[model samples]
Target: MKQTTMNRTQRTVCTVLAAAALAAGLSACAPLIVGGAVVGGVMAVDRRTAGTQIEDEGIELRAANRIRETFGDRVHVNVTSYNRQALLTGEVPNAQERQAVEQLVSQVENVRSVVNDLTITTFSSTLSQRSNDTFITGKVRASLVDAQDISANSFKVVTERNVVYLMGRVSQREANRATEIARGVSGVSKVVRVFEIVSEEELRRIAPQPAPVTTDDTKPSGG
Candidate 1:
């Protein structure tokens, strides 16, 4: 999938929702029908890591007052992560508000990097941030699909703002390799490692069944 100027992530999600409504109008097998997608074809998940959860809590804690004051108790920003990278996604009213969110988040400890995916709700760049985020996730999935050493199916990509969080059961080396690809993508601001290192024994248990095909996919396309 290609990234559009309007936040493709949000658009894609909305597209799925719209397609779902349309599919319901046309189909009798509602349960078997997936909106805008097929389950067996390819799956992209927002697989969050333990570190990402911690980072999210920390960010929320840090910005609780500002966000509440800005939105008047309606928490609009969506926070998610994988491998310690924190992603902030949602609409903010203005550029000042967006910057405020980023400034506050940068103060959090243990954060390797921040990808500011917050879009100003102005007409011009309203969807730019969102499309960038979706592109980041797609690129990461694509990398995993193309990498020979990585198990693309085991990892998940989560975006908060423009940051990419990777969650997977990978060895340290594999995780490092995945992070490298994520960091190398265009438009990626920073890559945060939020993975739980898997030992050889765990790998054997987690990947007992073999896959018929292979993909060189890695972590998030852009962080």
Candidate 2:
């Protein structure tokens, strides 16, 4: 009963956080979803190693800082890193700024590669558009959570200009399944996959192991 109660609390907390993020319209994109066993379940089911996760976070921060330092408010870019692969989205004034932004992100420490999807547009996305994108991101995340067959936590979702960008280490089967699900969401104009494809065997190899249960009979004797 206690375990069940804890699970319910965790879910409620995650739901509230997700709602808050949506309301704020933060650029971090997808609202965190509670999935699988418990809260923090998203990170638990993530394919990246703990070290890789830290590195990815650092890559994003450093890249964003570099872009801001270099271009100031002239260019609008969103850097999302998964498995050390950095994805650049949003708008730039021209082709030259787009290439420059990509170069800056690529120079960030530990970035394995970069996918530049920045549109060459003079005008950046407006507040209303960004709000809609945030809404779309939340809807897509919720749909992924609803799908029992595929692990929603495996994918990192980002939306810009109504295009949904998916990043993760997933098998072809999982990638296709996620794409279909993302496309079915109402506000998604397009879905761009940035997945690092792995074999099912590889996925199994990296899957999180279950914690060992301790019984009273197996308790170690005190010294």
Number of colliding residue pairs in each model: 29, 0
Q: Give candidate 2's whole-model lDDT.
A: 0.84
**Residues 41-130, model 1: lDDT tens digits:** 433222343345456557655555456665663335654444445566666778777777776656666555555676566443336666
Report the CA-based lDDT of candidate 1 relative to the real structure. Answer: 0.58
lDDT of 1 at 34: 21
- Predicted candidate 2 versus true structure: per-residue lDDT over 1-223, tens digit per residue: 9999999898766655654443343236544432223333333377787788789989999999899999999999999999999999999999999999998899899999999999998999999999899888888887776676888768888999899999889999999999999999998999999999999999989887765787798778998
In the order shown, the candidates' Cα RMSDs to the true structure are: 14.1, 6.2
The CA root-mean-square deviation of candidate 1, after full C-alpha superposition on the true structure, stands at 14.1
C-alpha RMSD (angstroms) for model 2: 6.2
Model 2: residues >4 Å from true position, as ranges? 1-43, 218-223
lDDT of 1 at 9: 79
Scanning candidate 2 in windows of ten residues, the lowest lDDT window is 33-42
Best by TM-score: 2
